[model samples]
Target: MRILLVGEYSRLHNSLKEGLEALQHEVTIIGTGDNFKKYPVDYCIFPKYFLQNRILILLNKILFRIFKLDLQLAEKGIRFWLFLPKLKNYDVVQLINSNAIETYPFFSKYLLKKLFNQNKKSFLLVCGEDTPIIDFMLKDQLKYSILTPYLNDSNLKSEYWFSLKYVQKNYRDLFNFISLNVSQLIVSDLDYKIPLPEKILIPNPVNTNKISFDNLVISEKIIIFIGINKSSYIKKGTHFFEKALAIIAQKYSDKIEIISVENIPYNEYINLYNKAHILLDQLYSYDQGYNALEAMAKGKVVFTGAETEFIDYYNLTEKVCINAIPDVDYLVRELSLLIENPEEIIAMGKRARLFIKKEHDYINIAQKYMDVWNRN
Candidate 1:
């Protein structure tokens, strides 16, 4: 199959491309290399004018504050307009998000129309919570979501201005247009599934070949690692994890070592946590995200979302991953339990690696995509 995957955010499409190629399928990816992470792509559409140049970058801030205009958006508009003709003649085209080009609805809708006309089959991936998904989250459909902090705390609402505004009538129109035009809508995780009940559910692909399982050795002192992305700190419930970590650090100062790194590049980020015993991932997801799954593939104990839906899907009573919650007390207790019982940590790490190898191996995920694409 000649598949064209559009947009890259979290190395999701890059890993999927690797899997498809392994299965002898022709796959092409067009993306911005996800900023500093720099994932591979056949076509790079990163708008470089204002963001890369120092003087223009400084001026962009001024433009945003005074005229309420974004230079970065303008760059994307120009680049995507020029790149539209190249986005044709693929057997299948998959969008990373509704606003894959990071432009206004007017432009995105215009582009989607062209995409629909050009491609044989076009699908949308409900990767992150989009406009409609954000609307559903605001309605509290799930037991808990990343939006929980914004809904419960007024102070945190400011941090999510984009999401709140995106769900409004104007922004949602773009998503509506894409939904009507796309051949199918597929979700990579449960967070998107709650809002989109009818959409196909496919687990995110993990490149297990790149990640090797090592039997975690729990020594006298345990190393706990938490990597923070400043953009999604509040949304990912980082404060809750930090508060819980604070108490754990004070209580077991000698037995535990906490490592906190913020907004580093992808390669350095992974290597930074390589020697760690535990990885604390997002607190608001209903399924394991890219980071958690990758850590699990490396045989690390990851504290992430493993809700009932995820548990039931895998059909295992054994706890391969720790369900991270928003409550500080609950998080503290869970960390304490793991700290006290070192042996369980090693056992859980092994189970977590096996789970990733079985459920998220990229080759199997690629076959699932192929099956969906071939279906009438």
Candidate 2:
């Protein structure tokens, strides 16, 4: 099958592409490299002129301030429009999200309509923030979510505008348009699956072959690593992790080594966390995101979303990763438990690697995707 995957999220599409290609299907991914993470894509629609030029960057800021217009998104739209000719005639086209290109809703809808008209089958992947996910959060369906921080403190509204914008009419229309165009809506993980229960639940794909697992050896100090993306600090409940780390650091200064970084590239981020025994991932997630899944594959015990829903679905008896929440005390306690009993960390790390191999192997996930796409 000739598959075209639109957009990238934490290398999810890239890994899927690898799996699909391994299974003898031709796959192409077009995306903007997901900002600073720089996930590879066959076609990169990043706004080089606006991003690289200092004058244009300043002008973009001014335009956004005065006219509430993001020139970067417009640039991305133009690039995608130019690439539309080569993007057609695919056996199946799957969007990474409703706002896959991260462009204005109206323009995104226009571009998506073209792809749908040209492609044989269209499908939508619910992996990231979109209208339905935002709507579900607004209804307070979950006990706690990424929006918990912003809901508790309205001052963080600015930080959450990227997600909150989906609730607007234009985005809602975009969602409706995509819904009508796509044959099926496939969710990536429990976070999206719980909100849209009827959608096909496909787990995120991780290339276990590329990620090697090493049995964690704790000699003197347990290294705890946390990478923060400042833009998503509030939305990801990173502040909770920060507070918890602070407490943990003060208590176990000699027993543990805390490594914290902000907004690094994906390669560097992975390499830096490779030595760590524990990786502090996002809070308020019901399932592990790509970063956490990759970390788990690397045999790093990650503090990410591993809720009961995830456990029950996986039918696990042992703890693979920590279920992070928006509570500093809870996070600190979880960290303390690991610190006090280093063997648990080693045990969990092994379980995490096995879990990824068992559930998230890229080849198996790609086959599941192929089955779904073919069935639809």
Most accurate candidate by TM-score = 2
lDDT of 2 at 230: 90
Off by over 4 Å in 2: none
What digit string (tens of lDDT, one per residue) describes model 2 on residues 135-221?
Answer: 999887689998887777889788888899999999999999999888899999999999999889999999998999899999999
Runs of candidate 1 with Cα error greater than 4 angstroms are none
What TM-score does each of the candidates earn? Answer: 0.96, 0.98
Candidate 2's error at 204, in angstroms?
0.6
Among residues 3 or more apart in sequence or in different chains, the pairs in candidate 1 whose N, CA or C atoms overlap within 3 Å are none
Q: How far off is residue 266 in model 2, in Å?
A: 0.5
Pick by lDDT: which candidate is best? Answer: 2
* Total clashing pairs for each candidate: 0, 0
**At residue 335, what lDDT does model 2 achieve?**
95
